[model samples]
Target chain A: MKIREVTLSTTPNAEAVADLRLGDIIYLDGLIYTAREGVYMRALEQKANIPMELPSQSAANFHCSPAAVIREDGSFDLGAVTATASFRFAKWLPEWMAKTGARLIIGKGGMSSKDYNEYFVPNGAVYLSTVGYGTGALLGRGVETVEAVHWHEELGIAQAMWVIRARRMGPFIVASNLQGECLFERENAKISENLDRVYEGTKPAVLKRYGETDDRSDEVIG
Target chain B: MISLDLIQTTAETLMDKAAIEIPQDYLDGLRAAAATEDGDLSSFVLQAMLENYEAAKEDRRAMCGDTGVPRWFVKMGNDARVEGGFVALEAALRRATANATTGVPLRPNRVHPLWRTDHNNNVGIGAPEIEYGFEPEGEWMDLITVHKGGLFGTDYRMLFPSDGIEGIKRFYLDSLVAFGKRGLACQPAIIGIGLGGSKDTCMVLGKRASVLRTVGSRNSDPKIAAMEDEFKELGNSIGMGAMGFVGKNMVIDCNIEVGYCHTGGMQMSVHAFCLSSRRAVARIFPDGRVEHRTDPNWFTDYQRRETIEWDPAREAAE
Candidate 1:
């Protein structure tokens, strides 16, 4: 069970992304930018100009908000970079990917296989899930510097687009690959095999909530 | 009287400690889990988290990027008094929260629900919620700060008495499996269950059980304590580990906190304290002496008193 670990550039090439297998650990170098809901809405819906030159400046779109601040002297102090759940951002990914030419979608949880097949595979993008649901300090150590922050005034710190220069940043798992296979789903299928045995003695609640599913195999997320 | 300056400064320190330090009890529980975790991916995650804890301490940075929502649980002895009263005490806590937001560089996570305004200081209306408790005696106050992740790994259900213990087990499993997938709930967490209180109190009890109580600590009730042990084993048997990978460790420990509810209904809530499990505590004496520790020691006998009167001597004698 020795897991293969690889180092990747933020602006990864097609062969690099295609070569990534599900479950391989990744360490990224080069530039990475934080972009979640705020950045999505502003760039996709509001038609606002993207602050950084995408794909050229960096192709890695990180779904994160670093524990960070701007000092009175207007310098940045960033710590513990971690990812948010990526499933919630599915709606805007296709458009964002096409527009930004992003090759890496890094975040907390991996997207569904359908999401991978639909746009991620077609766009030559793969999902990288942050290990430990975080390893914020370890990830923070990889940050060479906080290059810049965008939309702090309009979007606030949590949703601001933080551009960071990463030296060897990560411990991200290749949760999805060019083949549209999801590591999480593969693991989920294996775990679900024993659910009934673990739940043998338990009985369903007398009063069930609406829309509740007794299917242990089904994911809570879409 | 506990000086306002001391309270604020201690609170600021607690915030930093809570953010950066993995409480010892939780760290121990996690280490135990890591030892038994067989799944390769899951075991890797556990090891990385262990190293991350040391990195956070050495660098004085948050252990996790999502620092969670910071809140306070204030406990004071009946004889204890603050220098400027409770209003000023609250102001001091708020000031500390805002200061730490910048000082520790915590993400200013608070915002208006509808308007989505960020003060960039983790402070806003009803932000950094301050809940209070009073002990029967002593002239000291305890400040406990917990920075729990805001989203995922918590749920509430209304079950009638007829639902029985089997029903309770079902819902508990439901919560764990639901959030445990893809490590959304941050498995190997301290799972907290609240049973039999009003809906709000049930939520509060569950939350307190998860964040306030230390790992490996149990309920005062022997019967409930047994259930806690059973639930811990039950959770780990789920064949799921960190990030929903197949593994042997899903729960580090399980804690159940109960409150009396209506005769006809049983309200239940479940909460997970997450991988980082950030919490810090300090007890300040009226003499200006302050003590810092990891354990909150919140669920004392007085907190779970069953009778109408506060008579610790009689209870002890019994």
Candidate 2:
């Protein structure tokens, strides 16, 4: 199958986001920013002023921390770029999208369809999952330069907000679309159809832990 | 005595190599998987990862940004000695870890668990865990560095003796399917299983089985080796490929490590070494001859010795 690929701006228009389909590959341009628990807690919870102008400067919020460092002379030596799992950040995402007008939520795993329907669709946002999940070097090649890093002193490099200029920085898969459909969930349903056959000879453990589910289709993430 | 300077410098080089270079054994396994993978999305992911490795090598950058938590495994020959005692050697390893964190421009991934303080050097209390193993003879020391991603793709369970191979199979499938969803565990990985040890040792054995052993290597016991082959085939049959898409390449290989446990209880652990499977090894002699290679050769006969004494002739005969 010839997978569709598209180039999009970090600050994309509604039409562009609406045009995205589940499983479509994306290459991003313009400005993008990295934020995870540190940026969200500081901005949404502690009420620290957000460093960059959100949505205006960039609508793409990447759940990432690049392998980068600042030299003694105060220049950046940025290397591979990749994303962390996004499911853990679900709590703060709704507030973050409302606060920053984020259009693209890019990360490791896409969130649930419930997440996309409840807030992402309403906010005109969608989820883009990093491909291979280990394609950091490839993604790094797309990064033009590190524009700036915020809150490194306070939150450390892993959690700090890193603003970067992306030339064609991606191979992200459209994991969620404007209609709140989830690509991962759709794929899971297909794979689950054969779980019974694969697990035919296996027997449950004699001792079971509390809160353990035997259901093969149940996802560990919320 | 091996030079302290050589140990430290070699460790630094190992860190860089582990981060930037994908091991040949793993590369070969992945290529084999890519060739057999028929799922479109899964095939695309495999191809992209292949290209990612080349990009990392050409650019001298880390294969993955997470870079996992960097740790050291030191295996020494009985006759080998360090320039300084083990304390000084540990200090040198710690220094190398910190220096490489900035020099290689690695993300300073370590931090205070509660306070969330960042040393920005990947060094902190109990950070860069240094584990040691010793061999029977030879005046050489081996340094192995593994940068494995910390989160997801690992689990432990307590089972009774009644929970036989069938039970083991059940838990294995559970771990693969659970973390395999959405590619959380990073499928097409080296799946390691630890059995028969105490809870803690079970985790350690499984972890080592995943990161220490090379792809296609098998357990010494023919029975366990057969199980490894069967597990590898079973994992691939799950119909889930990379990113949990419908595919046929969930596991690149399966490794099982076992230890003697209490007769009443059986402890099990599962671990996945993901696509980047970053590991590098070097053997340094007392004369300062250093040999670098991808295979760690960690689980030698001495390591898996079942007898009370080191009887090489007896082991060889057996």
Candidate 3:
């Protein structure tokens, strides 16, 4: 059997950001955003601008950080983590990316998991994590600038949004875009395929529903 | 067979101890989660837990500064007799709490629900809430706590899912969303999953579960444990790794809890405690003995409470 080969599109950031070839694994070393609960929901309801924030010490010590890592696994660089587990305003992720042009995302703690498959897959953004109490590391880095997160002033804590020049961030990749060159998609697709197959191969469940044998005698002749 | 008074006393001691420490099983749970990890996010979370565990024990530090609301589990000996029943038990516990606080000063984290007020001493009218369960074999108590000396964050998302086992994942997830929405950063994170029981109990269980899960121990329940692993895997997949450090892990621990299943009429009621998923546990036995559980997994941490010797006649020996 002869199998034809196909090639994907290329981008200038590909080599610099180690961006995946829409299918190849690549390590990313660049700036990313952080967002969590309050900021997200408010944005969804009020359509307010907000920035992503990393987990604070309390959340870090208690909850896992919302980030992921990416590395090449053969020809593809699949994401290990996805969007933050605590999804806030994930619906606007595409819009956020459209505005920022930041191809990579760094949150996956609170958002509903399926958001990736639904919205993120269609968008160019890739999600991942650095979960588990990395509050100090997130904050200690030198900041370059920040965006709309400032609106929530009364809400004080460590897990806030800001963009900064990370000194030497590395081996970054977790859940990521499965739709294009991202590795998360492929892995997820593969798993889903296998699961589907298994589900198909299994026999039907033996139990009949409770109402299947309802007595016709009770029904009116009509 | 231990006496019922001994059991009640154990519960008293448990509450006092809980007010001051985090357990090791929780640390191990976070670490074990790294297996499903795919990047720096997962690794960083594991590392933070390890460091936190070290800091809490070696430096006598609290695992989490929040040191949340306090709760206890009293497993009484059915055959055993209480000198004066719950009244005596509660009185002794109150004394123990006061005595322990005078020196240990467990964080005063309880607040009046309606008034939104605080007592600051970690001791209020109903602080260190306790639950009584009579086990046929012997008397023992598991005092669990999360109380802080002062109220910290006041945001709604800051402490959602504060009630029960009803929808814990949603609560924790909501908290995560709030953190992002509020733009709080450098979050010293600790994850807790309160399962089983009604609202209040479930939340308390959540805090306890968080601190109790070892750095890398899986939940024994295959279904729930698998979910925990899946959560870590999915979280790591996102690359919210290492303090959202672009390569750090999104989570370190996914603490869990399992409550008693509802049995009969009025099935509407369910109770549980929060799993304050974090690292470090300081297990102090009845005879003033201290044993720390660092890992998040339930059984390990190289610790067991030493038996407290009881003189049959010397009740006043101190």
True contacts kept of each: 0.85, 0.86, 0.07
Model 3 lDDT tens row, A142-177 = 223322233323322223342333323322334444
**Which digits, one per residue and each the tens of the lDDT, describe model 1 over residues B1-318?**
899999999999999999999999999999999998889999999999999999999999999999989999999999999999999999999999999999987878888999999999999999999999989999999999999997899999999999899999999999999999999997789999999899999999999999999998989888999999999999999999998999999899999999999999999999999998989999999899999999999999999988789899876665
The DockQ figures for the candidates are: 0.88, 0.88, 0.05
- Predictions in order: lDDT: 0.93, 0.93, 0.37
User: Least accurate stretch of 10 residues (summed lDDT) in model 1 chain A?
Assistant: A204-213
Model 1: per-residue Cα lDDT over A4-89, one tens digit each: 99999999889999999999999999999999999999999999999899899899999999999988788999989899999999
Tens digits of per-residue lDDT for model 3, B203-261? 55555554444445665556777877755443333333333333324455454554543
Stretches off by above 4 angstroms in model 1 are: none
Any runs in candidate 3 off by more than 4 Å, and if so which?
A: A1-222, B1-22, B29-49, B113-118, B139-225, B242-248, B251-318
What's the TM-score of each model vs. the native? 0.99, 0.99, 0.41
Q: Rank the candidates by DockQ, best first.
A: 2, 1, 3
